[model samples]
Target: MAEIRIENLHRRFGDFVAVRDSNLTIRNGDFFVLLGPSGCGKTTTLRMIAGLEIPTSGRILLDGEDVTFLRASHRDIAFVFQLFALYPHMNVGQNLAFPLKSQGTPRAEVKARVAEVARLLRIEHLLHSPVGRLAGGDRQRVALGRAIIRRPKAFLMDEPLGTLDAEFRDLMREELRQLHERIGATTVYVTHDQIEAMSMADQIAVMDKGVILQAGPPNEVYRRPATMFVAGFIGSPAMNFLPVTGPVAAGAQTIAVNGAHVTMPKLHEPLNHDRGVLGARPEHMELADAASFRGRVFGVEYLGARQLVTVDTSVGRVKVRAANTGKAKAGDTVGIDFRSEALVLFDGRTERALASDLMNGAPVEGRRAAHG
Candidate 1:
């Protein structure tokens, strides 16, 4: 296993830029993910790393040696695609042995390696199965088996489980994570699915418009998003943004929203925007009688252990996650309160987070109920 370093990476197709000055260090034996929506250059970045696509500019270092211009075959990195790219004529065993065989690895060694890989992936029983007839999950396992069989310096997977059904994707997710643990190989995975990135990555780089928006561990990225796009992209229900009339000065502890003054963390830097946004995850809000932010319940969604209550506030509609309280109903007026530390303030013009208590690690003040 080896560290993969991408420095000032940029790729261009004619006049359009696909990746822009991307700088990232994928640690040795780390499960690093490039997460973003479609056309966000994640696959292009992964391809650049795999040596399948050369960068228009920038450097790619594999364990300190520059391999920016190396051929895909010369770089010892294995790439697994969304579509299981397997030989239709070969059996699973043959597919697994082909890389070694192509490298002129002796027959005895190829056989030994194929058997080892099959056992590791628990696909020994399907070794003789035709690749064309395997189930989606089984084909994915074989695809993975083929990648790992080479014992490459690193693994690059481009949505390897994208083609699987939801339930099987979940199953494969767990299996893939376990396999990574056993091998401890450096892996770079690209996906548009936040669930996959959050569940499997040791580190995540959130990208947009060919640029990286934020990068960190899953929890850190979720807790302290550097940009509004990131705050909205990472969570399921997404963060709720309440409009704030701004030009707010530094050190202010309150902001005006819909003619009501709401208590918030003192800002360390002034927001120069004519308007700003107060971001809070649904789970951070509570129903309190004395709270300043008031709204009328408009919709209530029962979600097993929790209920998502939609409220039409003075500013806009807001969703609050609370315990399955049968009490909330449409048209019921309620006061919405939130934890001060959990709030993220964004400059409306730039859509970037402002320095506040969120960045200072202030303890959360209050939540309606502990369980949600």
Candidate 2:
């Protein structure tokens, strides 16, 4: 078990910054995930901690010691690359025991340890199977076993499941989560796949353009995003950013959007028309009576449990999710209604949520459970 901390970390190459000024603390034995799209610097930051890339500035602390300059071989850490780095010639058992054997451990002890890990990974049946012949999922398990066998202080995995097929990926996700629970090792996982991060992480840090936008529990980050980019990036269909410019109806505490009257969300202050954006989640919207906003259904996507219905409203195209059985068809005229309570206000200029306490029932006339 180990605690990893990065303080004032920055990594730049020539004129471009790979990782900007960032600070984070990964607690002991937590399944922490660094999530972001490509070029967001998650991998660069991970490399710095693994001693693969030196931070141009700031410090890297492991457990309590500063090891920013430590070489990769000196860090008591196991790094599982995205490629599932394994020797084609080595069988599953040999690959798993390589670490222990390299240290000149006794043959019996190494064999015992390898057996233990192989059983733990459920790869014991394939012990003598050459890695080249193993399935993708098995190969991944072998790769993980090789890392876990080291019993390193922390594990840094860089998109280890990115290459697996959908079915195998889902299976490995559950297996990996359970594996972490059984071992209770400190882990930092990096991936651009929101599903992977959302499902597995005890805590998730959403990154973009080298900056950590929001860091919190998966549910918290989704429910109360600090910036517009986060709200738009973390969700599946993403949050809807509808453009609306109209007079504030103080008498009704509502705003007219595209000729439809809808209750305005509580903001820290009244709207100053500073390019305001009304953000709503697909799940938070529904088809209602004709009194609400009206639109023409553009399409309906049946996504197993629910259907995402797209409507070309006066403001723009909006996506509303309903139970898969809900009757919605293309070219149908429908009433689009906001949940009222689920609406959020964002200042376009800053691309940040307006300060409000709307999530709580009290509704401070201004701004905060979770989708996942």
Candidate 3:
């Protein structure tokens, strides 16, 4: 196990800056995930750490030793790409033993290691099967086994499960998590799928446009995003944002959504000088019997245990998650409530969070008077 640290990392291509000055510390045996959309520099960051791509300016440290200039073969890292890069002509046993063979391990040891990894991955029965004969999931497992056989200081995975079917992907996710627990190897996984990041990572780094917006546990980033981009990016159904114009209240501010007044929780930082945007997740917004705002249900989607209803309000269209009791339908008049505890305020101009204090449930002072 090894700790990975990046200091003032920057990557550029001529005049284009692929990655900005980024700093991060990945603890020993930590399963760190770099998550973002495509072209967000996540792959570039992973490659730099793997010694496959050199950073324009920065230092990378593994186990407290600087390895920024180390060659890929000397970095002591295992890289698993999205595509299963197995040799088609080789069987599973031969494929797994290839790495040890290249390193000149004794024949007996190579055979033992191959058997051990194949059994660990439940692929021992398929050891003699050709790489082309294995299913997609099996091939992926073989690729992972090959990477693990070398026992590198860290494992770097770049969307290794992107090509698998949904069911296989889900199964592999649990398998991967269990494998990490068993080995406790330091790992840095890169993916655009937020669900995978949320389920598999010990810590998640949310990135956008060559910059990391926030890095923390999954719940922290979801409940209290540091920026509007994160609030919208980290969740499914995303987060809903509404523009409001009003003075900050004494204890808290209230936004006039259409004619309905919705009180906002106090922010730790003053937000009176700039316009405030209200953000709430779909689960936090609900149709209730005695909600403050009234709206008409525009659509209802049945999703197993819960139903998602789209409500057209005077403020805007908002989505609400409710029990699938089959009680709500389109064109029904409904009262909508925003859970104050889950609400977040942002600067309308800059789109950054108004206060980190909101994350910790602290009460903030109001900087302006309320308006009716």
TM-score of 3: 0.93
Model 2 over residues 1-372: C-alpha lDDT tens digits?
A: 889999989999999999998889889999999999999999999999999999999999999889999999899999998898998998999999999988899999999999999889998899999999989999999999999998999999999999999999999999999999999999999999999999999999888999987787898678767779889988989998887574332333466676677775455555566387788899988887575688899999999999999999887899999878768999999998887767777767778776554556332212221111
**Model 1 TM-score, all chains together:** 0.94
Q: For candidate 3, lDDT tens digit of each residue in 1-372? A: 799998889999999888899888888999999999999999999999999999999899999989999999998999999999899989989999999999999999998889888888889999999999888889999999999999899999999999999999999999999999988999999999999999999988888989877787788778877778988988888898877665444356566655567766665565675377888899988778787688898999999999999988887888888889898889999998887777887788788776534545533112100000
Candidates sorted on TM-score, descending? 1, 3, 2
Q: Where does candidate 1 clash, by residue pair?
A: none
Estimate the overall C-alpha local distance difference test score of candidate 2: 0.85
For model 1 the local lDDT of residue 332 reads 92
The digit string of per-residue lDDT tens for model 1 on 231-320 reads 999998999998898879988888887776777777778987777998889998887777777999999999998999999987899999
Q: Give the lowest summed-lDDT range of ten residues in model 1.
A: 363-372
- The models' CA-based lDDT, in order, is 0.88, 0.85, 0.85
